[model samples]
Target chain A: MIEIKHLKKSFGSHHVLRDVNLKIEDGKITSILGGSGSGKSTLIKCMMRLLDSDGGEILVNGKDITKVTNPFRLAAVRRHFGYLFQEGALFDSMTVGENVAFGLSYLTDIPKEKYPAVIKEKLAMVGLKEEVAKLNPSELSGGMRKRVSLARVLAISPKCILYDEPTTGLDPIMSDIISDLILEMKKKIGITSVVITHDMHSAFKISDYIAFLYEGEIMLYGTPEEFRKTDNPYVRQFVDGSSHGPIQMKLMRE
Target chain B: MFTAIGKVMMNWLDQTGGAADMVRSAGFWLARSRFEFKQFVLQSITIGVDSFGVTALTSLFTGMVLALQAGNTINNIFGDPIFVGTIVSFSLIRELGPVLTGVVVAGRAGAAVTAHIGTMAVTEQLDALYTLGTNPTQYLVIPRMGAFLLTMPVLTVFSNIFGVIGGYLVAVYALGVPGEVYLSDITTFMGAKDFMHGFIKAFIFAFMIATVCCYKGVSTRGGAEGVGKSTTGAVVTCIVLILVLDYFLTAILAAFGI
Candidate 1:
């Protein structure tokens, strides 16, 4: 389980995360749903230790990563996470196969000779063909890039995977395929996941628990049914995508 | 006015402090990652061998121009161009070869490193590497730094040889000086220490360019615009520093009686 308590982050005069708190259970998907500028992505980045929180306790399996100073120890803590970026973020200089093989070659004790087999296996898991391995990331389409990014993350075999807007830009069909793959990851591998997305349908389909992030805080936290039943103006505004609700359009413009 | 000055000061301090931290981390990782021999070799070839054309061209022109002007001036006064080879070899081996080569690298390779690293930073590939338990300073910066340090001197040597050849062509054929006189004068006036002087300067310039460019690159923010800014910023900063450092290095070498 991961516990984020009193997490606060600010940029100059703008406070991005304000007294935010969350509890993410293991072996299931917990989706943090929020509109743009709602700090959902910031919350996950802070949890991943990519951005430092001005004030917070981020406990990963009971150890506070914020306080860890040693490079080796901090890296060891970070190794537990596999973060998939919003834009796939594959290394542009390397080919598709080399991208997935990078972590395997660098981080693991796996033999150098077995890297090709391992790369092939991970790409196949992401439904990527072996022929695409030779092509550069720039040559791939958006959906294929995301799948290759997923393959790269899975190469590390991290304890938990963090997805940031996994289905943001894809078509409905492609999004559903990604959602199915995410669900398969949870059901088949039984690994923990924290998905950050604003897509209500995808969140409802894949998440065991959904947390609504608003103004840098969790406005509501519960199962899908509980979320649907909530009449809170903030929650309603987001769930229904209503412009008439309490969430002003200007503030959500960020 | 005070606020603007304070902001500038703070920005300078912040960047300087960040550079120091990267240097520290790079030192630590470089010691542990001696096994990245393959990466070092690849980067060396890219930074040095692939950069042959531009550096060679710059050195060639500078040498040719130097010989041409010197030959004309000496011929006007003495009715014969004399000491053209001595002047070309001395000036090149002492200053132009290393300095011009350093400037070319700062403009070309330094910007490339910043663009490469800055794009990775903006794209969150750096975060991906971190999440995989790989220190980017070790995986990225160390190999590049190692390559630059290993190859800058070699590039300097290539510049020196090409520069002399260019000067020889100008002095003998273009200026109508005897080929034997020009060749013998180069052997006569230039010392081993003169070549070594520029060679040592190449190493220092390489270290500075690598550190400055990589620091700016890794600390890049914003996005595509930020990477463009970093590439420009790195090249400008590296060139200015290379020039300033050239003066200091010359002074120090002179003081050492080299």
Candidate 2:
């Protein structure tokens, strides 16, 4: 379980996250829904220690990971969490198989000779053929890259998987495929998964619980059914995708 | 006004703290970066291959220039053009060859490596490495450092031999000096001490260039413009450090009566 307490993060004079608190239960899928500049990405990044919080306590499995000092131990803590980057973040220089094996090779004691088998298994789990392993990331399509990235996350056998806008830029079918993969992984490995996305359909489909973020705070947090029934104006506005509501789209003046 | 100044000072302090954090993070990454053997080999070849032609050409010209200048000066003083071989070989091997090769490599290889790594850093590939539990420094720095350390002496040796040969060609064929006399003077005058001095300088130059280039590259910000700036900065800094250290090393060597 990952717990965040009284998290506050600011960029210069502009506050991104304000007195935010949340919890991600073990062996469950939680989706954070927020608009652009709504601090969802910042929250995940803060939890991962990719970005420093101005004030907060991030507890992973009852231990305060935020204050961990020793680098190797900190690395061990980080190794337990798998992060799927928004851009796929696949190393362009490495082959798909190599990229999948990247985290495993670094974090585990697995020998080089056995890596091919591990890579094959992980790729196969992600629905990629063995031949795709030798192809560079640039050669793979966007959907394929996302699958490869997912394969990489599973290869590490992380306790929790963090997805940052996993279905962004994908067609509806591709998005559904990725959403299904997330659900499959949760069912198969029982891994706790946290997905941060603005896509309401994707969020509603895959999430067991949904947290609706507005103005750097959790405006509504509950099960997907509760989320749909929420009378909160912000949550209602977001869920219905209504233009004439409390949420106003900023106009760009030329 | 006082309040504004105080705020500025505080901001500066904050920036300094951030820089310290970045340095600490870099040290951690450097520790982990050492594990990727394949990346190390690729970096080594990248640093060495392209610079080979330039290093060779630079050494040849440096030798010829030294021979021409020393030939005139020594002829006027000793009335023996043959002594030019000793002067050329000794100077080239002990100082000029290593220093020149270092400068060439800095411009050719150091800048390229810095830009390549710096772009990767700005693109968040470095962060990706960190997230994967791999240290950027250990993976990136160690290989380049290893390549620089291993390849530099070889380049220096090539420079020294090529420079001497260039001088020999000029002395015997171009300047009408006897081949046997020039060859014998070069063989007799130059010793292991001179070679040792050159090799030592080469090692120091390699460390300086590799470290400075990597530092500049890894520290880069902004975007493509920042990468370009880092590349130029690495080459320039490497050249400056090489010259500065050469003078200091020469002084130390002289003090020891080498």
The best candidate in terms of TM-score:
1
A23-58, model 2: which lDDT tens digit per residue? 899999999998888899898888777777888788
Flag clash pairs in model 1. Answer: none
Model 2 residue runs over 4 Å out of place are A11-14, A236-254, B1-38, B73-82, B256-258
* C-alpha-based local distance difference test score of model 2: 0.83
Kindly report the TM-score of the first chain in candidate 2: 0.95
Q: What is the TM-score of chain A alone in each candidate?
A: 0.96, 0.95
Residue-wise C-alpha lDDT for candidate 1, range A110-180, written one tens digit per residue: 99899888889998988988888899999988889889999999989988999999999999888988888
lDDT of 1 at B183: 84
Where does candidate 2 chain A have its weakest 10-residue lDDT segment? A245-254
What residue pairs clash in candidate 2, if any at all? B29-B137, B30-B137, B30-B138, B33-B138, B33-B139, B34-B138, B34-B139
Off by over 4 Å in 1: A249-254, B1-9
Model 2, C-alpha of B14: deviation from truth (Å): 12
Q: What is the lDDT of residue A232 in candidate 2?
A: 87
